[model samples]
Target: MNSIDSVTLEVADPTAAARFYSGAFGLDPSRVRVRSCEAPTTGFRGFTLSLVVSQPGNVDALFAAALDAGATVLKPASKSLWGYGGVVRAPDGTIWQIATSARKDTGPVTRDVDELVLLLGVEDVRASKQFYVEQGLTVGKSFGGKYVEFATAPGTVRLSLYKRRALAKVAGVPADGTGSHRLVLSGATDPFSDPDGFAWEPTAPLTVAN
Candidate 1:
């Protein structure tokens, strides 16, 4: 069956995009509806992201094919130094990423970056950082603390929030303004939304990982 694993848009008007998403994408009015008060709170204007995944399956290739067909790629696909590897977006504003089969159940010997951290898009760098700070985040000194170093626990993996532009600039890739993406809790996380309205919380704090 044809399926999408994840969806995130850096929209200006999330309230308006709520309708646009439901109609244009044919997302269910009921299922597509995500509120921060509920679960997945990761969007502009603070809306929880509703991610879709195929059941009993692994269909990364099919999803990749869909992007090749007509999806406007804002960013090209590439391996991420942060562990999880996937394109940030396609032009005309659509975000796509694969949820790799790197579950903890699979064991650290077979873990993928996908199982550790998740990326998110934000409007402002300092503002977004402040949001995470308000959530009681203790900033780490990575990229000069421009990228947040939060915890997933004490002994698990690490996730950091990076500005799209800076990351792309450093990587020598074009920065395709990606808006809102979800950092789904993989390990023990204390999830909370940053002040800028990005969904994140400390499931685990910063630590070393091999």
Candidate 2:
């Protein structure tokens, strides 16, 4: 089964970026990697990393923690048509959404964040959905021509696609820009980029440092 092993972000300083995420969101420092960029400005345009938690408090606390860690608040937490959620921009300019559903979850507490969903804003949802289906990902739930979500195995991050303009409206960001995404997804055997330029590379084998 295809699973997202890790998501890498490019930043000016890997150590600093790793530290910020680890401290603010409880992400393992090893999971975040950064590289130098010569570009003048870097901002999120087409994708967002979603943190799905089990409880409403989790959403609030995580959102607060992000703000306390020097993250720029894009949207304050509130109940929305989509559920309870808030948006924040990481120090490195990556956009993140922390949210929880109204549905009650009786699952045991495993972690502060229950699951990660990589939501990509694609120019064409239909074409992007077809491309992923051909790459062996099963469709979980798709909405007419507006949205598509992929089924993922337990403990794996799920991938979702939505129209660029729609996603921009949801995230409160502009829909036009051209530059490096500064994000990389790993797990697929063959490296590929979706219609929106989100790159997925094969998961590298873990190494033991003796």
Candidate 3:
């Protein structure tokens, strides 16, 4: 029943990040940022944090918005022979990838639940394990001690976590946003929820649209 609404990347500029994300994810980059920030501050349940900003900057506004709001510029924007992308360091040391495009959208589309996994590195694995146990979850298995996964609910998707070192190894890239942080979700799981916890209940049953 649980689902993902949005996966936020704390960027130097929400607009730039959104633009990069929109072009990359094929979503419309039409955000009402001032409205989004009018609400109360939130914890990890929904979004990681709330961003507050008023207007867009320029044709280069995406970069400007994030920078003005305190996003560090990691890479400058440029038209690569391969693709269009630039990297920026977020306020919290998270690397933000602003790409005009991505390669893979090859899909045999289907109806299912999309599990939004959060990759967190906690100080104590034992304490983290106990916390989830209290939150109505059972730790399933450790992926070679690098990760420990938990189930969302009965027959639900698995939300997994891993140490930074191990995650970097699995991702085959540095733990820097220069690459991209992998929010590893089960490809076999259902696509069910959005960021608001609203059900995106696909009317049709599971069928891969090729």
- Best-matching candidate per TM-score: 2
lDDT of 3 by residue, 1-210 (tens): 232223333333445444443332233222111001222222121111112112111113455545665666655655556544445544433344344332333344221113223445443455555655554456777655456776555333335555555444332345433222212122223444322222222223222111
RMSD of each: 12.2, 3.2, 13.3
Q: Which run of 10 residues does model 1 get worst, by summed lDDT?
A: 47-56
- For model 2, state the Cα shift of residue 123 in Å: 0.4
Cα TM-score of candidate 1: 0.36
Expressed as tens digits, the lDDT of each residue in 1-210 for candidate 1 is 011122233343445545544433444332223222222323222122212223212223323443544444323433344322243332223344433332222222211122223344344656776665564455554454356555444423334566666555533345553334433332223545554455433333322111
Error of 1 at 121 (Å): 4.3
Model 3, CA-based lDDT: 0.37
Residue 50 lDDT (model 2)? 89
Off by over 4 Å in 1: 1-70, 75-93, 97-113, 116-118, 121-131, 138-141, 153-159, 167-210
Report the Cα lDDT for candidate 2: 0.77
Model 3 spans > 4 angstroms off:
1-6, 27-115, 143-145, 153-158, 172-210
TM-score for each of the candidates: 0.36, 0.88, 0.37
Model 3, 65: alpha-carbon shift in Å? Answer: 22
Output the number of the lDDT-best candidate: 2
